[model samples]
Target: MKNNWQLYVLILPAVIYFIVFNYFPLYGIQIAFKDYKAASGIAGSAWVGLKHFENFFNAYYFKRLLSNTLLLNVFNLLWSFPIPLILAIFLNQIKSPKRKRFIQTSIYVPYFISTVVLAGMLYIFLSPTSGIFNIMRTSLGMKAVDYMSEAAAFRTIYIISGVWQTAGWGTILYMASLAGVDTSLYEAAEIDGASIWQKIRYIDLPSLVSVAMMVFILDCGKLLSSNTDKALVMQTAGNIPTSDIIGVYVYNVGLGSGQFSYTAAIGLFVNLINFILIMSVNKLSKKVTDVGLF
Candidate 1:
């Protein structure tokens, strides 16, 4: 310990951060089982074990919220997971460093945009009256449609926008994995008269297996969660049928309506489900592919 004192000192901030922000907040999780009065505080709150969970289970919007949250994430995972892999593969094949760097930078720029700003951009670009899309449709002799308000289009828009924003940034890990590939392997493939597609299939994809599995396992853990702020901002009266997810519900009824205990219960329930899902996925992945986060 004395030999690595500087190393430990460097890590102290991260340790303290987790302790203060992550571990300390766990103390308040008991509120999920309590009535959680503001005057009573967390420890003083009246215990009402499972009451909030039961109420939420019986709520009319329960099924819709669960389905919406699950479907949105499932669709997002399906769409967003592969684009980055493909981009990384294609980027790896780019031999010119300058061209590759420029493309990589261009693609990564969108990920830096804030969720609220992206949502506002969506609103502006999809505005039924003055939006460019509507204008283009009108020019092409088509009816203008309010995409943001269309419940049928909600998931598609969400998934597409999320992919656009994140796919490039997501390539970082895969690109790193690819960068570590032995140059000799490519040389050997070339000597064997292997084509680019064949080389990618035989070399690149296989090398990415472990990393991909870890990424998939992590993504599965978020199956029941969504970005609340983005969804909340994008939500509209017409799209509530599809856009009303558990996070938004928790935000509204928990903070807005002052039902802290109720929302905490919902949050706990979602966390438990996510935990079960991630564990199940990790176990199955380890069993089948011999690669997992564990």
Candidate 2:
């Protein structure tokens, strides 16, 4: 530790930031067990034990809320996780450096597009009256349909849009990992006249598994959290059941109803679930591949 004193100094600010902003706010978690009042504040709020937790668990919408959150995460993981790995492998294989770099840059542009703008674009592209999808359908002599109102299609739209936005950035991570792989393996494969597919399968894919597992585990840690901004922007009255995730639900309950104590309890609950997910996945990773964040 003493030998790397300068390196430790570099990380001190980030350490302090997490302690001050993240760990310190945890002291207010007690508000979840209390009937918090605005004037009284957290410290002065009367302790009500598990009243808020009980209320949340027994609430009429509890199952629907939990199911929607789980479904969104599950479908998202299934569709979005592998795409970056596939795209990264393709990016890594491109012999022309200029073309590869240009393609990578082009794909990443979508990620920086604001969620509100992306959601608006989706509405425009899927609008029954004048949308591109309906326009194509009209050219085929087919009827236009309201895609945004289709609850069954909501999950697919959300997942595909999310992947389109973030997959390119994720590909960069895997590509970086692939770059560190020993060049001798590829040279040896070339000597054996190995096909590109063979080289990718035997060399590139194996090297990516460790990094991919870490990324997967990190994502699993956030299974209970849905990004509120994106969900809210994409949401409409018609797709309430499909789009209302835990984060959105908490925002509505907390600020919309001013139920501070109840919201605190729900936040704590979500954090606990996230914690369990990360721990469990970490253990499984160690068991299967003998590798993990720890």
The model with the greatest TM-score is 1
Cα displacement (angstroms), candidate 1, residue 22, comes to 0.6
Residue 49 displacement (Å), model 1: 0.7
Residue range 1-294, candidate 2, lDDT tens digits: 999999999999999999999999989999999999989988898999999999999999899989999989988998789999999999989999999999999999999999999999999999999999999999999999888988777889999999999999889889999999999999999999999999999999999999999999999998888878998888888888788887888889899999989999999999999999999999999999987999
- lDDT for 67 in candidate 2 is 95
Q: Which segments of candidate 2 are over 4 A away from where they belong?
A: 1-4
- Model 1, 112-195: lDDT tens per residue? 999999999999999999999999999999999999999999999898999999999999999999999999999999999999
TM-score of each: 0.99, 0.97
- Please report the TM-score between candidate 1 and the true structure: 0.99
What range of 10 consecutive residues in model 1 has the weakest lDDT sum? 36-45
Candidate 1 clashing pairs?
none
Q: Predict model 1's lDDT versus the native.
A: 0.96
